[model samples]
Target: MYVGLVGCGLVGNKRARGLGSNHRLAAVADKDLTRAESLASQHSGCDYFADWQAVVGHPACEVIIVATTNDTLAEVATAAIDRNRPVLIEKPAARNSKEIEPLIEIAERNGVPVKVGFNHRFHPALIQARQIWDTGELGDLMYIRGRYGHGGRLGYEKEWRADPRIAGGGELLDQGVHLIDLSRWFAGEFADVDGYVNTYFWRMPVEDNAFMLLKTIAQQVAWLHVSCTEWKNLFSFEIFGRNGKLQIDGLGGSYGTERLTYYQMSPEMGPPATVISEYPESDDSWEMEFAYFIDCIQHGCEPQGNLKDAKAALRIVEALYEKHTSGKSVRL
Candidate 1:
């Protein structure tokens, strides 16, 4: 498959490398032509474009990947879908649910598949945890706890992420949506949401921290907190069930090693049985996620992380943002 990628930044580079051997970059685009050219130079026969629209319209592109800023995600994906091309859009998909709503409608109407980049779900530890959950080893799921954060660098406030108009809602929309999506994947639709967002350290207009409590109809809860104020980078997610518990820590790289610990309850209680598994390999979540997207494209099925999931996560984010802005709790 030939992929047309828009956004030749950090994520764009990851996407290109994650394309696997079966797919090749057919066209690459970025507002900065030099960036596009740089990426295009690395991939043989790949063309460079200054306008994303050209990549979307490129005759050789069978699939499109939109790795642009939050505000342009939906716009670029929509254009690709309009061309009857499948699209892989980076997470949050859009600035808000409102922005994603129309894209969903258009994609559905066009019968074009769109995959949202929720790559965290493909982490090795999480994948192993899902298998454990499926085996009933954890029994009935009770709740999920997730905390993910990173310390910002110098001049971080001057980046596009600090601009609400470009990055949407800050840390919540950034790393927070991954936690929200994972929660929904395990606990089902949330019936209630209670949370707040705040700007603790960064001077940006958006909040640097977000705290959330999401509950399913069965009372299964997801307590999540995402931040950019943490002096040390971290990622921790734990799932508690009636019979056992699963704890996942780190995400490789600066977040430390990736590991999962399973604690199975003893028949008589007391300490319980424990098993630990660690993944010391470099992060392959991006490649695995792109592979799933490719599978969806080949099998004529919708992606696991589609626009609907993106919209659901965005709604949770918007709810918290609303609560913080209006000084009131949002019921939904």
Candidate 2:
């Protein structure tokens, strides 16, 4: 398939590499022509444009990847869907749930496929964990606990992420959505959302820290926390079930080595049997996720991480923000 990528930034580079050898990046675009040109130069025969609309309308491009800022994600995606092009939008898909609602309607009306880039779902450890979970080895799920955070670099407050108009929200919308999506993936839809968001370190309008306590209709709980103030980068998710527990630690690279540890409870209680799996290789989640998106496009199937999933995550984010201001728990 020929791909058109909008946004020639860090994530855009990752998306380009994730195309693998089977697909070609035929067109690229960024507000900064030089950045687009630079990305285009890396892929032979790739065209560069300053206007994203041009990439969306490119004659040779079959699929569109929207890796632009939060504010423009829905806009670029809407243009592609309007042209009958499938889109793989970056996570958090929009500034808020409301921003993604219209895109959902447009895609459904056009029968266009749209996939949200929740690459973490493709992590090898998580994949194995899901297989184990599906086998019922974890028994009835009881609860989930997840914590993900990274320390911001010097002058980080000057980036687009620090600007509310551009980022929409702070750490919550940025990294918190990932955790929220993952939790929903494992446990199910949250029936109740009670959380708080605060700007602790970064002098930005959005919160630097977000804490959430979510519950399913069955009362199963998901305790999640996301922050940009951590001195050390970290990612940890633990799922507890009646028969055992699954704990996923790190995300490779700065977050440390990716590993999943499963504890199978003994009928006799006491110490349980432990199994650990580690993924020391570089992150291939982007490639795996892209491949699935392509498969969904060709098979005429819905992606696992579609706009609805993104909207669900964004709703949780919105609820948390609202709860913080209203001082009340939100019923979803």
Candidate 3:
């Protein structure tokens, strides 16, 4: 199948690369023709256009991939849906819930499929962990906690990612949205939350550090912490339950880490819990998510990263920011 792509930034390029052999990058569009051309060169026979409208409306393209700035997401997404083309929009789906909730309606009315790019849902370790939980191997789940952080990147400036007005929130929206969505995705729908966000450096107009608490529908509480200020990195998840506890440690780090640990501790006459089994290293999450999107487009199926689920993640993000900026408790 021929797939059209928009945005020539980091995620866009990585996605195009991941698509490799199974799918063809039929067309690409970017505000900057140079970058668009550069991206087109990466694909043997792809066409590059300055305006995404042309890319989206191209007759040969069956799927439109919107990987641009958050602010421009809705416009491009709406256009793709309008053309009756299936769309796979990048994570967060939009700047806020106001932008996301409506897409569900638009998709239903148009009878075209829509997907958000929350690729972490396809992470192997995360998938295995979810399987463990579903099998009740961990017993009655109590709490889950994690952190996703890293040093800010240089390319942030080349794109609209550094600007709050265009990027939506800051690191909170960029990285925080990922952790928040994944936390809830594993824990269940969030029932309530409280959090804080701050941008201490990066010379950017968005938050650089963010910490959040999520109360899931199952009454499970999870802590999600993210910061671009960290010198190194940290990515780990701890699940506590009635049986004992299971600690899963990420190997590499956020965005690149490909390792996991599944050590469980059980009471043994009051002795300290011991490590049981640890998972071997795995694949890069970026590649995993990208491959999944292309597969969805090829076989004609709704991506596991559904629009409604992405909207749900964005809702939690919007609520956190609202509470941080307005000084109110977010009940939902």
Candidate 4:
């Protein structure tokens, strides 16, 4: 596959690497021409464009990867989908679901496949967790609890992430979206969402910490928190079910070693039987998601990270933000 990549920053580069040896980077684009050129230079026969539009319409490219800031995700993806090109857009999909609705309409009308970048779903531990749940050993799911946070670096408040206009909502829209997506994956779509967001530590207009409560039609609840105030980086997610429970911790690197544990309740139940799995290498979720994207394109199937999933996550996000802004409860 020939690819047109936009952003040329941390995530964009990761996407490029994820394409691996089978796919070619036909063109790269960034607001900074130098950054685009730098990425393009790494691959022979690759082209660099100053404007993202050029890369979007580049003749040699069959797929589009949008890794730009949150605000540009929908705009660039909508454009690419308008041209009948398949797109793997980095998530939130846009600043909010409102920005993504039109893009979804466009994609459905044109039958163009759109994949959102919720790469965490592809992590080995998560993949195993999903498999275990699918076997029905967990019985009916009860609730999920997740805590994800990171310590910000020097001058963090001044980054583009600090600007609500550029990055949309703060921690909720950032790492929080991953937790929301995971909850939905295990428990199905949420029917009610409520939350609080506050700039407890950062000086930015956007909140540095966020708390959420999501409930499904079945009353399966997810209580989650995401923050940048944690002095020690952390990631923990626990799911409880009638017959068993699953706990996933860390995400490799600064998040520590990735691991998942499943506790199955015996019928006579004194102590539950526990199973553990660990992933010690660098995160390959990027590569796994890319492979899934390619398979979806080949099989004419919608991706697991399709626009619908992104919309669902955004719905929860918007609901939470509404609750925070209005200081009232949010239903649906």
- For each candidate, the alpha-carbon lDDT, in order, equals 0.93, 0.95, 0.77, 0.92
- Shift of residue 327 alpha carbon in model 2, Å: 0.3
- Report clash pairs, candidate 2: none
lDDT of 2 by residue, 144-164 (tens): 999999999998999999999
List, residue by residue over 1-332, the lDDT tens digit for candidate 3.
Answer: 68899999888997787565667999999999999999999888899999999999998898888999899888899999988888888888898888876788888898787878777666676777777778776677788888877776776544577777888887778878777777766677888978888877777677888888888777788888888877677667677767655555554435444544555555563643454444445445656765676566567677666788887777888888889878885978
Name the weakest run of 10 consecutive residues (lDDT summed) in model 2: 197-206
Task: Tell me how far the alpha carbon of residue 16 in candidate 1 is from the true structure, in angstroms, after superposition.
Answer: 0.4
Across residues 219-312, which tens digit of lDDT does each residue of candidate 1 receive? 8899999999988999999999999999999999999999999999988999979999999999999999999998998999988989999999
What lDDT would candidate 1 get against the real structure?
0.93
Per-candidate TM-scores read: 0.98, 0.99, 0.89, 0.98
* True-structure RMSD, every candidate: 0.9, 0.7, 2.8, 1.0
lDDT of 4 by residue, 50-155 (tens): 8999999999999999999998999999899999999999988899988999999999999998899999999999999999999998998899999999989999
For model 1, the run of ten residues with the poorest summed lDDT: 323-332
Which of 2 and 3 is the better model by TM-score?
2
TM-score of 2: 0.99
Model 4 segments beyond 4 Å from truth? none
**Residue 101 in candidate 3 has what lDDT?**
67
lDDT for predicted candidate 2 compared with the true structure: 0.95
